[model samples]
Target: MTTEASGTSPLNHPEPAARTLRYSAFTHDPAGGNPAGVVLDASRLDEAAMLALAAEVGYSETAFVTGADEQARRFRVRYFSPLAEVAFCGHATVALAVALAERLGPGEIVLDTPAGEIPVATRVDDEGAVLATLTSVPTRSRPASDTELDATLAALGWSRGDLDPELPPHVAFGGNDHLVLAAASRTRLAKLDYDFEGLAEVMRRYGWTTVHLVWRESPELFHARDPFPVGGVVEDPATGAAAAAFGGYLRAVGLVTSPARISVRQGEDMGRPGDLLIDVDPHGTRTRVTGGAVPIAEAGGPRRS
Candidate 1:
């Protein structure tokens, strides 16, 4: 596999470096969705190597494909943040799925993540972008304890009055845990100044991957903003894992009808608008998050290793 970088040949790059591909997930535009790094063949890279590469890429998370069974379309995917390994990263998963679809053709691919087994379906759109939908692990949610709510609110500089009365705060789990806090208005959701260290401390203590901050625009429309200080990101433009968790939160709290499909608009405040389509099944606990991803401009085209 050869990807010609400017002023250099990929042949000279050894191992995982030559296999890295960058993409933005949850949007067809590069300037939209959250950027992610994908290493299609990381068979030779150790945990240290992966972490270093992730820091160098500086994306919210980088997905590394450590093992694969080509004929069965099954692979083991690991996600790494700049600072540490993440249990699961939905945006990176989508990015990797689309990148693989471009080379291996649109189809279903199974990923074994640290969180659980994930099945992603990919298809090419009319605009020539590969759209991917990932079925999250079993989702669940529970009301946040008073202590938890108080700590998070203190860190976020938000009070109970600022929260939506209809959607109560909860701890939701998709592949990982997330604190679901619904802002009373879009204005409240947009202004995102918070104590990063304080929030990170709270998140770490609670084992939360992100604070799934959201505002309900309508029965089916919503605006979301995710503060991912724990991941070493000030903000995440598009967060598929959190979106999936929020879906479970919504359904659990009776905010949406079962067998619902809702649209989540995120990253708009950051100028990188991304849209996620979440489908929550009435009978099943798993949620499906759908979106398209685009190759980062500098990567040029399809790459493989």
Candidate 2:
């Protein structure tokens, strides 16, 4: 299998596809959480090949493990959505970390992503569960422009009154930009039939990864649902990128004081319940997202031809 990495065009495309792995991120059960595709040995694959395999996996995003520094335990990783390559993907990162831990013996791995350098730490718990935590790139949040907010609302079929007065509309970035909309009532967040093409257009215009719909149940607990039309998925069961972004948004909006640990419950509405733990530092720009992932035994999510 000749590849661009060796200054040659790839002749056998199926070699790369057979190496893909399928895992569900943010949950220990394969049936729960967001499904992610990981290619641990994607060093031989190019961008176009990665994108094609990601589409074939039919997941929101896939993480390709590329260049590596074995001495430093650092690796170059790339994220590709079904439609295009993205800067970063949090759930996919978690899934990749756990998958790598199984082979690398689980301690710490640094990932060089397009967004920035990400540090992931993996630990085996007392119950023999592998937990992976990813520290996001510097995160920031800003109030959404009125025009942007209006268009998003229109696409979501939501009016101004449906929004929470306290949690105003904002664009938050953990690794990618996500539109954070706080619903005043949990009921409003439950029913989420939206205009797919309309939202995808708006997201592409604003460079948004997903629309993060949230409802605060308590100070340290929240419920979340993500609309990922831009990724060619109707909804992402669990969104680690948005959760990291939300931690930044909470601190920016005075919703939480510094150095807070909160839990975001997601995928429940979709019957694939997963929980993401977000830790915000008092002085650091990075937010930490923690979750567990398990491989799918039945389907590997790659079409080898």
Candidate 3:
């Protein structure tokens, strides 16, 4: 296996260095959300270098802005997990948008990601906080295969009896694919003790980025937990991609009556609580996720072992 250092020599060289910024996404408090590493200018770095930086950052995922068109406020963004590159990441995208908004002033920004083009709108709140809303690519959801569902439940130590019959298991996609498993109760969702390797294998086979474990509190309120074994993380504090996908799932399954705005409370079980706002249009194909991010005080540097 190639080590991170051997994969990229840019970190050792002096010229054309990249600057990384750390931000906690989906929350105004730096300590209350998912932290993501954002490289504002990564045009000089190759895939190997980006991967190395992501691994060094030790975050579930990192956002790299490789190319930018200043006049149009457009950028080419890539996402890297600690273990591999992902097609898209919701929290990282929101973090990158807020990071850019802080510098360029809040407005609309277009991001070209591996999955597709995503348009993000940023605005300053009454409290002087920058919030970003990203419209995802067209979303779709389908019932999970019996084999995959059974295997995933076994890996999670959950049984069919533990599932909420109203919200059936599904494979949902907004920008990336996720397995949506709605637990019968908040207690069932709280007790998350899954076999990491087992879940990772299942996720890899299905090309799923995360397993969205959720419990509905009401028509518009929910609590969610995401198992991101594929990213080498046991759980994600905040998951925007999964939230958008879940919106699509709710609409697809007829759980939602009309165009609705849903609020997802996540990370509470892990003690790093965050909130995500999701908007589903009755006539639109895509879902929009909104959240706020704050910059972490720590300067970006080499990863400490």
Candidate 4:
């Protein structure tokens, strides 16, 4: 099936089924987190078509819910970036969880993603908005080669001196692979200008999803940014995948002991600031990423064919 939604098209056609796609994984305020396009019901969309729709949505990622089973809790979920389909997306998962909570009532929901089964727990906050926590897949970390590290640094226009001596280079995988590079200074993190195509080539070669550029502000807090050229987006405002990977990065390197929580402030550079909360547990292999989301106003326009 082919489906489309147009937010800005002069030409007109039959009214497309409109679902308010919000930028979730945000905090209480809508503008304070990563933006995600949420399509609550996407049974009318096909694989190719969903990819196109996600591209048109122009966010880091877009989530489509195909259907829900009898219990009204289990759903088949798919994620698409601007460039292609992704196995999973954490922020989008949070957005979907909140959306589902509103529709199905506050509780837990099982999302069957291509990567694996994701269980999202949702609850109403003090202000009565839905907040969600998603348990990620088993996370693992591996050392990054010297050559790979040098090349990645070069692509980002940084030298070895700019790297934080405490946190060395490591490639971590939660739901996806991310190359974690800690910045020596917040100044370095604020000034981000990377070779998009060059880095994309390197990432594709290494099967990396995003380059997790981060600065350790404190023991329990960090500032982060993610370059996602592979997904046809320059940056990801809020990235759950990177957060999960970071949890593993901290653990493998002994930066953070088991059973800890970290706050990641992202999207501040983009003017759409957002927050991501990551829970690290030593008992289990999986990392938990949590956040909140809100819906955006629907834009008026014709359907895109």
**Candidate with the greatest lDDT versus the true structure:** 3
| Least well predicted 10-residue stretch by lDDT in candidate 2 | 2-11
List lDDT for all candidates, in order. Answer: 0.87, 0.86, 0.89, 0.81
Q: What tens digits encode model 3's per-residue C-alpha lDDT throughout 1-305?
A: 12122223332233234777899999998888788998877877999999999998888889998877755788889999888999999999999999888877899999999999999999999999999999999999999999999999999999999999999999999999999999999999999999999999999999999999999999889999999988878888999999989989988998877789999999998888999999987667799999999998984322222
Could you estimate the TM-score for every candidate? 0.92, 0.92, 0.92, 0.90
Q: Per-residue lDDT of 66-151 in model 4, one digit per residue for the tens? A: 76562557888899887888888998899888877776688888888988988889999898888898988888898899989988
User: Local error of candidate 1 at 277, Å?
Assistant: 0.4
Model 1 global lDDT (CA atoms, 0 to 1): 0.87
TM-score for predicted model 4 compared with the true structure: 0.90
lDDT of 4: 0.81
Q: What is the TM-score (0 to 1) of candidate 2?
A: 0.92
- How many steric clashes between backbone atoms does each model show? 0, 0, 0, 4
Question: Residue 290 deviation, candidate 2, in Å?
Answer: 0.5
Residue 151 displacement in candidate 3 (angstroms): 0.4
Error of 4 at 233 (Å): 1.1
Superposed Cα deviation of residue 237, candidate 2 (Å): 0.8
Off by over 4 Å in 3: 1-17, 299-305
